[model samples]
Target: MATFATSDQLLVIIDPAARQTDGESVRIAKDVLSAGAAAKLCLPEGPEEFARALDRRGSRRPVVIGDGRALVRAVTLLHRQRELAGCALSVVPVGDTALAESLGVPGGAVAAARAVLDGAERRLDLLVDDSDGVVLGALGIPPAPGRAVAARPVPIASGRPWYRSLVRTLASRPARLPAVPSPCAARLRVEVDGRTVVDLDQPVVTVSVTPGTDGVASVEVRPLSVGAEATPLLASGRSVTVTGADFRYRADAAVSGPVRRRTWRVAEGAWGLVLPAGR
Candidate 1:
C-alpha cells in the first residue's frame, strides 16, 4: 500500500462545469497524483467549499485545477488570509486559452502539473481595485451603456490618456466594436493626490486606474474620444474614490457595486505568489 506524505498534500478545485464537460482532465490529474509520492490531491465540491478548504489549509501550496476564475478565487482567499507573506499559488489551467495564454501557461494540464511539481516560487504584484478587490496583472473597465459598452475592437491603452477600451453590445453578432462613451465618466470624479483632475459635467464612459507606489494613482480616463487625448495622471496617495448614481462596474473579471461610492487603498507587497521564471 502506497501512502501519501503530509508535505505532499495538495488541494485541487475544479470548476463544476469544466469537470462535467471534460471528465478526461480530472481523471488524468487524479492519475498523475496517484502515480507520484510527491503530491496528494484533495478536491473541493464547489466554489464556496473551495474557499473553505483553502481557509482550513494553513500553509500548503494550493493547486487549483480550473481556469482563470479558479486563480482569482485562490488569490482572493489568500488576500483575505493575511497569511500570504510567503505562500505559493500554483494553477493547472484546464480550460480557456485566454488566461493561460496571458500567463504563458502551457496548454496541456500534465505539463502545467509537471511544472507545479518542479517550479520555483516567485513573487508577483497584485492590484487592488477601488472596492478592495484583488486583481493580478491588468484591469479592464468594460463599457457601460451611455458610458462605455463591451466591444471587441481592441482599443489602444498606450499613450497618456490611454484609450482604455471600446464598448459594444453583446446582442450584436460578428462583434461590432464601436467607440462609445467613457464608462466611468457618468459616475466618476477622479482625484490625484487630493487634486480633482477629472470632474465630468456630463455622463462619461469608463475610468481605469493603475495604483502605484507612494499614493501615486496612474489614472486613465476613456471617454467618447476616438480622438480624446487622455493624459495619464499619477497621483501619490493611499485612497481613490469612485462615486456615481449607484451603478455596476467590472473590476478585473468580477462585477461589483451599485453603491454611491467605492474606495480602494493599496497594501504594498501584501502577498507573495509563484510566477514564471522570467516574470
Candidate 2:
C-alpha cells in the first residue's frame, strides 16, 4: 500500500451514466472516497457540465466515476487543456470495466475508491493522432475491404470545445455499422519511424499499434495469405504511419475512418493515473 499526504484533496466527478446505471455503486464509491480524504463531489449531467466541473476543480485531484469511456473523456479533456501531464487522475469503474482493468485499476467500486485515496501516481504513455484524438488502449486496423475504406458520415470526435462532442459520442451507444459484403485484404503502406514495413502492393490482413516501453509504440502488420502461413512484420518506434485508400480504424471503443492516411505517435508518459503501489 502507498501512503498519501493528508492535505491531498480530491474532486469526485460522477458521470450521469454511472448514476443511471449503477447508483448503488456510485454511492458506495462516494462514501468510501469521502471517508478517506478531503473530497468535493460534482454530478455533471452532460459534457458541458463535465467540462465546467473540471475547470472549477481547485487543487483537487480529479476522480472520475464511470466506465472506460468516461475515463477516456476525462483524460482527453485534461489533454486538450494541456494539464494531463501535471494532473494525477483516478477512476472508480461503475459499468464496463474492461478498459479500467487493462490499466490495472481495481474492478470493485470500494477497492477503486480506496485506490484513489491511497494509490501512487503512475505516468503512462498515450497515442496521439493528427486530428488531436487520443487513444489510451490499443488501436487496430482490421482487414475488411469496403468496410475499412468506407468512411462513416458521422465522426465521433467533432469540432466541439473541450471535446464535448467526443464525450457525447462516447457516452451514447454507437450506431450499428452497415453489413459489408465480406472481408478481404487491404493494401496499405505501413511505416514505423520512417522505416517502411510494407508497401501498398502487399495486402495487409491487419494492423495493430499499442504503447510500448521507452516511449515507443509496438506495431504489427500481418500480410494476407492463401491458406498458407504468412509472417507478420513487427516494429517498435515513436511513430507509426499508415497510408491506403480511405480506411477506418478502431481506437479503444470508438471507430474513426475512411481517411487516406493516418499517423499516431507515442506521447511518452503524457498522463498520470492513480494505481496501486508497485503496479
Candidate 3:
C-alpha cells in the first residue's frame, strides 16, 4: 500500500559529467521541464556532491538528467527519502536510455519531460542490498576469463548509433577476462528466505531479482562462460542474501560492493513509478 499526492513540485539533479559533455541537451530538458513545473537544477560535482544534492532534495518530485546511472542515483536517493514515498519521478534520460526504455520512459528529452507532465505513477520493484544500499534495476557480476562488466563503467551509450555519435563509447566487445592467469572466480552463497538455492565456487556473471506479491523472486542470472545466454532464476520469497569475498556486482547501472556479503529484502511495493501502457 502506497500513498499518492498531486503537485507540481520537483527537484532536478544532473550528473556533472553529463552536463559537461552535453550541456545543451541537458539545458533544453531542464528548461522544458521547468516550464511545466517548479524545478531547480542541481548538478552533482561527484559522488559526495551527488549524495549531498539528494540530502537537500526535500519533498519535491525528483527529475534525474543523466543516463541509467542518473536514474539509479535518483532511485537510491528516493529509497532513502522514504518520507517522499509516492512522489513522482521524472527522468530526462540522456545517456544509455536502454534501461530507462525498459522501464517505459521515452528516450527523447521532450517526450520524457512530457511524461512527467502527463504520466501517472506505477509501482516498481527496488532491491535493498545487505549493506543497506539500494539498486533500481539489474545487477551484473563478471565470470572467469570474462571480467565483470560492472568493473569498468561501460560507456552508457555504447552501441546506439545516435548516442555513440553523441557521447564517448565503451568497449565494443562484450566483457572478457584477461589472457594471463585467470582471476579467481567469484563464489557466492545465495539464499532465499533462509533456504539455500545456490552455493558454488564458480564464476557468476550477474544476478537480478524483481518484486512480487509474496516476496522478491530471482529474475535472471547470467554466467560469463555461457556466452550471451542467460538463465532465469525463479522468483519467490521476500528476502535474498548473497555472501562472497571480493565480489564485484552492479545494481542496475550503478556499481558498488566489492564487499564480502550483501543482503536484500523486499521493500513491499516501495516505489510507484511510470511504466509503459502495457507493463
Candidate 4:
C-alpha cells in the first residue's frame, strides 16, 4: 500500500486533545499548513468525528496535528480500516511528541507543518497482535505480585500537569485497569520465534520488545535474581509470545491486559509514515 499524493492537497485533522493542550501551537500549525497547501481542516470535537474525517478523506494527504495519543488514534483507526499502508500519514506534533519525534517528525509545530507539506513517505514496521492491536513504539512487561488498588477517583490534586488531566480521566475510570506493574519479580514465559528464552520457573524483572531493522523485533528479557542480579536474555525474531497468570504490559503510552497469553508478529513495512526527506 502506498499514497498517491505528492503535491500539497491535505486533510488536516486537528485532534481535540491537541486543541486542549496547546491552542497556540495548533493555530500556528494550521496557519503554516494553510499557507503552504490546499488544506481542508477538520476540528473534530471528539474521537468519532476525528475518525470520520479520515474515512472521508479522498485523495487528500492526511496531516495530523496533535499529541501522541491523537497520533496513535489516527494510525489505529487507519490500520483497522486496512488503509494504513495505503496512505502516507504526516503529523505536526503538539504536546507529548516523543513517538512522532522518534519517527523523524519534528517536535516543533511550524517545522513539522513544513515537513508535512514537503516530506517523503517512509515505510515503517509495527507490531500487530493476535487481537488486532498494534504497538507503534516499544512494548514492555513489568512484574506485579499484588492486586490493583481499589478503583476510585484519583483526586485531581493541585499542581498536576495539564496532560495529567487526560491521564487522570483514563486512570480514574470506573472500570479497573490492570494496576501499573510493580517492580517485584513476576513469573512469566517469553518466547522468541518458538524458542523459550524465559520460563515460568524464572522470575522476571522486565521484558521489552521493539521493532528493529530487517523485519525482526529486538527482544530482551531480564530475570529477577535473588543475589547478584542475573543478566538479561536477549533475542530477535519475527514473532514473540508471552504467557503468564494474568499479567499487564506497558505498550507505548498505555498499559494493557491481564491476559493469560498474547502473541505479536512483526508486520514488515506494514504501514507508511511521512518523514522529512533525507532523514
Candidate 5:
C-alpha cells in the first residue's frame, strides 16, 4: 500500500550525535535514501545548525536521522516555528531506538530509509504545555529519589509576597545547613479537566499521561503504599495539571524542570509522521 516519492520531495537531516556515535548507520541510511530518491541531505553539528537546516528546507519533507532525542528536538523546533502541522516528518532512529520504536518508527537504518520513500502520512496528537513545550509521546512523573528528583534547588524570582521573599532570603543565609532529607513520595494535586483526582494530602508514587488517537490524554496516578488491593486512579481528558513542591518529569527522552506546577493538554492531529503504508 506504500506510495512512491521522488528524492526531490525529501530532505534528510543527519543529527551530529548519530554521526559521532554510529557513522556506519548514518552512512547506510544516507546510501539508502540517496539511492531511493534525489533527496537533499543536511548534517547539522549542533542545535543552531539544525534549526538553520530546517529553515532552509524548501518544499521537501524532513526525515530525521538519529535517536529519540533528535526526533524530539526536530519536532520541538517545528512546533516553535508554528509550521509543524504543515510538515510530515519521518525518522530513521540510530542509537537507542526505544522511543522511536514506541512511536512505531522502524529501527533499522536501511528499512527506515526505504519507508521514508514509500510511506503514508499519519497525523499524530501532541502534548503542549503552558510554556509552549511539546511532548511527542508519553509524559511521566517517576518515583521520588528517581530521575525526577531535583539535585539542587533552583532559584525563583521575587514576585511573591514580602514575607515569602524574606523567608527565602533567611533560608539561604545559613552558613551551615542541616543535612538534606531523604527522598520521599511527592504530595501532588493532580487534576483532570478541572476535577481533582488526587489531592495534595495524598502521597503519590507515580503519574503517567499519554495522548490517545481519539484526541484525549489518558492519565493514571498511583498512590504511595496504597496496599496490595489498591488500584491506580485513571481518567481521560484533554488537559491534565499537576501541582506540588518542586518536581521534575520525563517527557519523551528528556527531563524537564524542578517546577512546582505543570499542565499538559492534547493538541489533536497537530503533526504528521510518515510510516509504512500498511502500518
Candidate 6:
C-alpha cells in the first residue's frame, strides 16, 4: 500500500545469497520480471548496498528475490525506517523460503514473479522488540544461530559448567544442538500482557512466540516437570516480556541476544505483501 495505485515501474532487488545458492533460479526470476514490467534491477554484493537500494526506491514498488533471511532483511530495514506500513512488498523466494511461504507468497520464481505483476496486497501482523527488532515468523528460545554448533549456559545450584552434549552431523548437513539446557535447565520469568505465566523459581525447557492471525502474539513456555510432564503454559496477548538470566533467541532465521530482559509487542496489520490475487 505504499503507492496509491499500482504502477508498471518496479524496483527488483536480487539478493547475493540467491545467486550463490541457486543461480539458475535467479536468472529465471530476472527474465520473468523484466519481461512483465518496467523494472530497475539492483544486484547488491552485500547488505549495505542492499539496504541502500531499497531505501532509495522512489515510487517504484519493491520486489525482493532471495531466501527467508533476505526477505527478513528487507522487512527489517523498512520497519526501521517506519516505511513498512506504507510499502507493499513483492517476494520471489529462491532458497529456503519457509518464512516467505508461511506469509502466503507463491513459491518458485515463475509463480512468485507472476504474483508480483498480478496480485493483491495482503496486510499482516508483526512483532517488534524494545530494541526495534522485528519478527515476521515464529520465534524460539534456546537460540540456534549458525549452521555449526550452539551452546547456552544454564545456572545450577552449584557454580560449574554443564556437561557438553553433541548431536552427530551427516553428509553436508549441520548438527542441531539440544534446545533446552540439559542437566541444568534455565530459569526464566515469562510474562504475557503484564501477567506472569512462568516465574524464575521454576526451570524452563523452552519458549516460543508467534504472531497469531487474530492480531495477538501466541506465547508458549515449557517448563521442567518434577513428577509428571508439564503442559506448556500458553497465552495470547499484544505484549510479552521475559526476564532472568541472559538468554538468546531465534527470531525468524537470525539469532539475537544475550540479554537479561526483552519485551515484544504486536503491531497488527503493520505491513503489506503482494500475493496471488486468488490465493
Residues forming the 10-long window of minimal summed lDDT in candidate 3: 141-150
- lDDT of every model, 2 decimals: 0.59, 0.87, 0.68, 0.85, 0.85, 0.86
> For residues 1-279, could you state the per-residue lDDT of candidate 5 as single tens digits?
225565447788999999998999999999988888878899988999999998888888888999989999989999999999888899999997998788777888888888888888888899999999888878989533544453566455566798677767767885565567543578899999999999999888789999877799999998877447348899999999999889898898888888999999999999888887877
Assess candidate 1 and give its lDDT. 0.59
| lDDT tens readout by residue for model 3, 1-279 | 222332467788888867876777888888887788777778778878887887777777777888887777767776776743656566778867877887778888888877765576776666687666765655555422344354655456657688886564334556576556523345677778898656766555556665553446554544435445546455467787777777777676656657777777877666766543334
lDDT (Cα, 0-100) at 116 in candidate 5: 87
Model 3: how far residue 211 lies from native, Å: 4.3
- Candidate 2: where are CA atoms >4 Å away? 1-3, 143-184
Candidate number that wins on TM-score, 3 or 4 = 4
- Which sequence of candidate numbers ranks them by lDDT, best first? 2, 6, 5, 4, 3, 1
* Model 1: residue 43 alpha-carbon error in angstroms: 2.5
Model 6 weakest 10-residue run by lDDT: 162-171
For residue 101, model 5's alpha carbon misses the true position, in angstroms, by 1.1
Clashes of 4: 0
lDDT of 1 by residue, 1-279 (tens): 122242466655566655775679867765665465245455677878888877776545677777777777788877776666656777777765456446555557676665565555655445666545775544434334454445545543555432332223323348444655333346456665566656656345666655443334455655443475554444445556666676566654556666676666655655554444444
* Top-lDDT structure, candidate number: 2
Task: Tell me which residue pairs clash in candidate 5.
Answer: 7-38
Residue 234's lDDT within candidate 3 is 54
Q: After superposition, how far is residue 85 of candidate 1 from its true place, in Å?
A: 2.2
lDDT of candidate model 2 versus the reference? 0.87
List model 6 lDDT by residue over 72-133, tens digit each: 99999999998998898989999998999998898888998888888888888999999999
* lDDT, residue 2, model 6: 29
Better of 2 and 3 by lDDT: 2
